[model samples]
Target: MRESQPRESGAQAILEKYDRESQFRLNLGKWGLIVTFLGVYLTVFHLYTGYFGVLPSQKQGAIHLGTALGLIFLLFPAKKGMQKHQKTVPWYDIILAFLAMYISYHKVIFLDSILQSRITGYHPFDMILSIVGILLVLEATRRTVGLPIVIVAGITILYTIFGKYIPTQLLSHPGFSIDRIATNLWYQESGVFGTPIQISSKFIFLFLFFGVMLVHTRIGAFFNDLAFSLTGRYTGGTAKAAVSASALQGMVSGSSVGNTVASGSFTIPMMKKAGFKPEFAAATEASASTGGQIMPPLMGAAAFIMMEYLGVDFSTIMLAALVPAMLYFTGIFIGTHFEAKKRGIVGLPKEALPNFKKLMLRNGYMLLPLIVIVGTIMIGFTPQRAAIIGIVSAYLISLIRKESRLSLKQTIYVLEEGARVALPVIAAVATAGIIAGVVSITGLGAKFATGIIALSGGILPFALMLTMVACIILGMGLPTTANYVVTATVAAPALINTFGLEPIAVHMFVFYFGIVADITPPVCLAAYAGAGIAKANPFRTGLNAVKLAIAAFIIPYIFIYDPILLLVDVTIPHFVLAVVTAFLGMLAVSSAMIGFFVSNSRIWERVLLMLGGLLMIHPEVYSNVAGFLLMAIVWLLQRNRKNGEVSQSAAV
Candidate 1:
């Protein structure tokens, strides 16, 4: 077994580095209460909206953005390290916070009146507000989501102005006046109040609030325990448990790093103890945790954005995601099993494993809320209604268990925490609105699609490759939610319009690659955090994570090639066929990648398996047959090798 150190820095250090949610509330007592009050207020506002639909879209968006922006300024420091030990709000931040409030309140004060005035042009006050709003949103985005998105948005704004000078007329615009640009971005429905922000305001917060409530009620722990009990007695149990546990946890939790730290702290050490290398252990946790974003039921807040973008119900996305997401986790599990076989590792001792039956009996109630949510949604309840009921039912279930029950104060904290956790998303979504607006106003989405199609020579495969690369690059520092919004806005149109691909397929395609960035090198935030906990080198861990998640990289292409994988335009027979071949493809790919199947694979065997998997993964019957034959050949060879070795041993 390779020697591995315990985490050098504790959870605090890992969180501060990777998670925006770990920021200090405040040092001053009064300021702390004030911040808490604001958080609670935001949560309540969303809850109120959910229960009783209040106000028009613009008004609701204004209230939501205003509240979130104010809290963001109050909570996140202007400078990073300054907030480490300091508690008091800086005077500048306080001013900025008030300015954010003023900006949010602008829609309330001016929007209806602007409409009533019948004036299409920007007044002086409107211009100032627009300029201030843009600057404040940029700074707030910098403080919350980091500089990548801010820089992107800033460049877009510059392009919106000076773009006409460029030779290309498609993306470039006739130079716009400052007043016109400000008026459009600030006041237009297409700007900060677009679908992204609108969805963020309406649905994302409610779901996140429910998720926080679910966590406070101990569903996360139940999930981890549940996974452990089910998988702990199997080969490579600890690592398998990580895959299972991360999938279970991800169904409810939205944040990748949060889930990584939450589950990795338990699974990574167990994997290391089971004799996995530190890099492999860390990478396994990262890959598994990052997968939660793609998992169903609660597949992060981005799914809500997709709901709006695709104009489909949540069930459609959930059903579509079911097969591919499972294949992703199964691939990881297979890799772990093979790695364990290669290392001569075994499952936990019977005495060390949790009792699966007892765990289910004791903690089964913890799943009631999820069941209620899933059932209600499937049975035709609105998602918000389902979530509200889930929260209520979950709270009631919590009352039955001492460990899971929440006190009144604790419940309030849950609400506050939920809203606090959503701040960065609010900022990202609103700022994403700016990008969407720019794309819409400048016709950049169409222009980019045309250019990419031209570059790709109108080939579907080439268009997909270009989109995948774009998603991976854009997703480097952004959250999955923001990553998808930006990618779909800029890149999805290329695949859909250029290749005449389905919207859902293109969206899912970009979404998968965007999320793969979390486990991809150089900026794999989830992988880095997992490595921090496993005390391994971050880059190597990220690479290993990429290897473990090979299925995610490949499965998207499968779904894109055959929308049957996405349950689009599908018959039952076709869906099953697509699913079976895809599953075999995953198995084949995992076998080749891990260099093991029925027994250890030889080099030529591995190559054969790879060839077969690629063929089967494509949706052609002849190719599938050819691929299966190649795999069957490899499997028989491996079996023969194992038999020969056994015979030699018997002769000895």
Candidate 2:
């Protein structure tokens, strides 16, 4: 297939614009600095309220409005004559800035008194203020993200009013009055200020701030060096290094496309140098980078949303994600290995790989921030506190070396950059909150779950398959975090209530499928991003990524079926058996996908391996034994083929 050059260049230009602008060129630092400080203040205020629950509803709405407005002032393009230009803030920006501060101050100081009387008459000034605030938020939404999401939010608002007239089984509601809808969406916690926004302010922002600190401390470079030291001398080593480094970066980056572009620039070129085709190299990096969302420690903002929705601890969610994440990356690593072997490509020169001992001696302290984060969380510190500590540790560790130390100016840059990256995420979460609020207020969540259950005929596997399809479809268009939020609220509950799966397992199932959408067709943004770098066919790169990540597509279903793999409802013996079986199953799946195991595989062997993999994934002891036997037979056939080759040579 021919690559579409127009789409590739358009995407490249967008990414380059963001990357270049992130550096604050053309004297935009002053506005960047002001907007960034507002972002920090907003984040801190939300965190405080989240921990103490002191803020009233009207005040919360005001803060939300102010933050949304500031984000707009920071991100929106200004009109310069005939052309729309991206430039520094103008005078109107300062006006908007002061307005934001005034809104926040008014809410913090005066809104509490107004809320004291339940029967207080509606003041004309209050009504006007509220309408203006809502309009500002809508405009901010349009400027920060594209128009599609704003349109979706508008439809949801319309649905809240006109939904009663719609005739459908899945759509049933008595509808709400405009005042009630506005009150619920604007003045209450259920709509714009819902759990999505709460999670963003409290957890996502802190972690995002932590990621920025780590980047400033040179931890990103440290990960790259460590990945090179570990894997750069193996077959398809550069690709493997990309996979490993991306996995580490994913834990912190919270973005699949950003992580792909960041890691792919270095790894894709190296893979190409090692004889990998540009498209395949791009696809490999794309697939691996997308998996980072599923990796543990910090599986994007979705993990926090899951924890909030499930009322589970962060550690439990992280623990459950370990095996699935490992399997996803293992699949990518194995696929890269076999591809290199098939093409007879060699590894990088030994001298090219980083010297592990020397590198560690110089930059070992960079790892301490992550260690502190994990240790603090495990010891029962709140994730917020742990994140604060992590950020501090990142800065302190950077001081160990003069080159890595962050100057005050550099620190401000990190703060501003973090805010810039966080703006869209905050918007996404806040907008999603409205959807969730509507679902909750209308009991649409239960109705949606019930409908899916009935459609699946109450069968677990069929229901899971339907859920996976739904998640992928949603993920294709939405960000991973938003996708997970929507899926978990609507579909995950069905799995738990109808199928009796553990809550953690159900949420994780939805989360995995949501992330896999990045590599799926139609809207595979990660693969498309990679194709831009490789100058490859976007669809073909996406197809290769799907093939390479086959195990990710299957492993979630495995854990869903045999909950023991998730470390739920299991004895020690069962846990061991499940792990061993799942490990072997992943190997079979990888081998089948790669079409190589000791030698080139025939169609029959590939079929057998696939069946063996599926069988091993099932919980039945009989299936396990059968899968082991099938694998043994394949091993013997390959050995016999090798011996027959030697015998033929001797006879000749």
Candidate 3:
């Protein structure tokens, strides 16, 4: 219960540190009213677009960016907790807000003429505002998403301007002029209004808004109760429940830290109270929550963007994500089971478990919207349409269930919350648009890919390793949308365009690594959030999280080499083989990491499990046999050890 509450200053501080949306807001009557109006205005704009139609991509993205800027300046202070006026907007932020709106309005009204003149080139007003607009995005992003992405975006812009001098042939470009760069970035759909922001504006925001609505219906409570009922009575039950509950919650929420904080509040405490160590308890929640972004249907907004990029449908992605998602959670489940076995931990008391049948009967309606989203996506509907219908279904079902019903005030609050929550993503995607634009204009993507491939001596495995390290480093301090867009823009091209990996496979490969950065060391925000709740060390929680999530690191490569794992180019036998090998590989790796099997594993068993996992995971028939044989050997060793203990116990 104490973990569930943010009363501890440490948790509050950690929340603010990792989650930009969790910062202190000045709760003034007048200020709240203005913020509410701004928030509702954004929600209405998106809802109207989602239902009727969206504006031109350029116009839509500009308006979206402008509204987000105004909200960020008002809601998030330039410095944390440094509001100059308690109940009033600071003069500078107000100026920036109006400037953002002014640029957006001009872009919409004069955009046609500006585009026509771009060849002949730039009116004085166009150039000035373009400069201002670019700066505004960087500053606003810094105020919202943090300095890492802004720094990355700035370096990209500077590279666009100065790339001709890079001397290295592979990395060099003839370079783009300031006016040319500014025009493309500000006006064209290829730049600040590119696919990334377009997806965020048109698709991702609807999902985020729907997510807030989903949360309001108390679906999270249903998930938590369901997890407890299913797993709370077994060994390591609470930790297993945490894994299930966090993964379920993460699937829709798409934010690793946000999901950790939300469900970790409930699951982390239960885990610690059930005799799990604080850091491991926190790590379990952190890793499982990170996996949610890769969960199908929503996949935390990246799936929709991938659909747009790959020119495929959401159904294809949902199908592809199925095996990987299952394996990811299964690995965590195995880790928790072994942890429980090693520590001799027992489950929560029977009284603590919810009555499964009654609970489902009473609350199952809350889950229908998820089904609606999945069904519609599979049954020939666009994802946007699917999301819209799903949201409406949720609303209708809520009216039928009084406990889940949204009062008029509650509805308004959710709307405001939805808009506020989406600001960080909106800013991140728009800035990513700048980077994407530069990549496009300079042909930097192809060149960068060439350099990386050449550096790896054209070896695919080596290239993948290089790409993974790049993703992890760049992914630090960046949100998922921005991280995915950057990697998809630059790194994905190397695999697909140059080296000829399957497009979807390469994209997914980049996405998985990018997402794992949230749980990797030094800048692991999700693990930091878990540490906050468990009162554990941040780096220690991150280390444990990486250990538990080893499957995420290894599975992408499995699907990449096999493709059968993703159900691509596979016979039924091959599909089944991939599934069996992948799961067994997961089992081996997890048991190796946890240092337990039939009982506590020996050093040899751990090494055997590690090698078996690597070999089995590679998808080669011979390697699978060798891997299986090695695992069987380890299994027999463990069995013999078990018999020796049993005989000794009997003799005693």
Top candidate on lDDT is 3
Considering only N, C-alpha and C atoms within 3 Å, which residue pairs clash in candidate 1?
27-87
Give the alpha-carbon lDDT of every model. Answer: 0.83, 0.75, 0.86
Clashes of each: 1, 0, 0
Per-residue CA lDDT of model 1 for 304-332, tens digit only, reads 88988899999998888888898899889
Clashing pairs in 3: none
TM-score of each: 0.96, 0.90, 0.96
- Candidate 2 global lDDT: 0.75
Candidate 2 runs further than 4 Å off:
1-33, 36-65, 78-84, 90-110, 113-139, 646-652
Kindly report which residue pairs in candidate 2 clash with one another.
none
lDDT of 3 by residue, 1-652 (tens): 0112234465556677788767635543355677788888898899889889999887888788888888887777788666424556677777887888788778888878977886787788888888888888888888888899999989988999998899888887888888778878988788888898899889889989888878888889889999899998999999999998887788778889888988888788888888889999999999999999999868877777898999998899989998899999999999999999999999888887998888888887778999999999899987778889988887888787778789888788788888988988888888889999999999988888888888899899899999999999988967777888989988998888766788889999988998999999998999999999999999999999998999999999987887877778879988888788888889999999999988899898899999998888888889999999999999898889899999999999
TM-score of 3: 0.96
Candidate 3 stretches greater than 4 Å from native: 1-11, 83-87
